[model samples]
Target: MAVNEIRLSRLLRTSKMDDSENTTSFDDRSEAYSEVSARDCLAEGIIGLLLPTVEQIDERVKSTRISQLELRQHIDTLAEDLRALSEKQQIPYDLDSYVKKLVNAKRRVVLVNSILQNTQERLNRINQSITRENERRTALLEPQVSTPSEGQ
Candidate 1:
């Protein structure tokens, strides 16, 4: 009977140790899961912030492109008017100043279009970078997402 009690005590102690180990393992996994959840939340927040800004930038780029087109049309119209005035009318006292003004406007349009093109290119690069980052986030998240489902 004493031997049997000793064996039972050893079995109880072993079972308790197993339970303790399981609890520790569960705690460690739960902490890791919490950390991963926090990382996912942060990534989602960053995506939310970045997407809207990228869309706004795209809208601005389109608006600027339209403005460039309008400016080109204006330049063409001014050139035509100047050509007709020179061809059919006597040179007026203010003609030189008027030509100078048109030239200045053309120069300003060219400068603005150049700036807009550069800005559009930069925005494109930024959008690409954001897309790449989103893809990377998805890649990081996919395996974590799949493992539990696969186990189930």
Candidate 2:
């Protein structure tokens, strides 16, 4: 049948032959058979023990693949979220430039207001000086008119 079975059968047949023709004793032949049987049992036991380990390794590989897939999904989700946030933060105009322009406009307004205030102050001073001169001239003319009329 199988190669090992054929070999074992051949060995058994040879062992059963007349002892005078074969120098091997009966005890020696029996001992050899027992040794071969022990080796086969040991080989079978090792294979049986290793089968579960192979299965466990296969299961672990599958689990790792699943975890990797989930991690990839999470990474993709995070990437999408980051992209959305980027889009939301993106503005059509430059905010810093706009703020700078506003600041410049405010400075210009302040400067113009200061100039207007200075001009108004100068005009008020001129008006006050003219009023004082008019008052002095009236005072001088009133005394002259009174003296002239009394003499007439």
Candidate 3:
């Protein structure tokens, strides 16, 4: 038998012996008294042994609950940090898009400026050609008039 069972049997035997010695009659009352005392002692012993284990279990449960709560708080903080980091990661992409738009606009402006320069150069060439043609016509007309006056 286990130690607790041996101790409980011993306690029952001692209570029966004490009751038989104190009472003259080995009646039902004496048997009842011994049984009650044995039961009481057994209950007290069981409670005594179980109390510390119960207390230790309660302490462990409390610590486990505290640890679980701390882990949840850490997870919440990490989630917030992850959200902030995600937002920060998008900044480079937004900046890249903005820069691309600016570059496209600059390219359009440069293309327009090149077309305007070509058109201005063509207009200047046409103006010079027309001025030369007008001067040549004036010189030919003046020489023809002088030759007619000298022949007469």
Pick by lDDT: which candidate is best?
1
Q: Estimate, for each residue in 1-152, the C-alpha lDDT of model 1 and write its tens digit.
A: 54245334433433343444777776666677568657756876887898888779878877987987888788779877876787778655446677777778878877887887888788888888878887886677555555544544
Best by TM-score: 1
When summed lDDT is taken over every stretch of 10 residues in candidate 1, the lowest stretch is: 10-19
The local lDDT score (0 to 100) that residue 105 gets in candidate 2 is 55
Q: Write the per-residue lDDT of candidate 3 for residues 69-149, one digit (tens) a residue.
A: 565556456555655665789454444444455456555645655564565455455545545654664465345435534
1 or 2, greater by TM-score: 1
Question: Which of candidates 1 and 2 is the stronger one according to lDDT?
Answer: 1
lDDT score for residue 80 of model 1: 77
TM-score against native, each model: 0.70, 0.42, 0.42
What is the C-alpha local distance difference test score of candidate 1?
A: 0.70
lDDT ranking, high to low: 1, 2, 3
For model 1, the superposed segments whose C-alpha errors exceed 4 Å read 1-28, 148-152
Can you give the lDDT of residue 117 in candidate 2? Answer: 55
| Candidate 2 lDDT over residue span 10-126, tens digit each | 455646656476465766866775775576557546655755565565455556545555655564565556556655785644344544554565556456555645655655555
> How does each model score on lDDT?
0.70, 0.55, 0.53
Error of 1 at 53 (Å): 2.5
Please list the residue runs of candidate 2 whose C-alpha ends up more than 4 Å from where it truly belongs after superposition: 1-15, 90-152
lDDT of 2 at 147: 56
lDDT of 3 at 98: 47
Candidate 3 deviates by what RMSD?
58.1
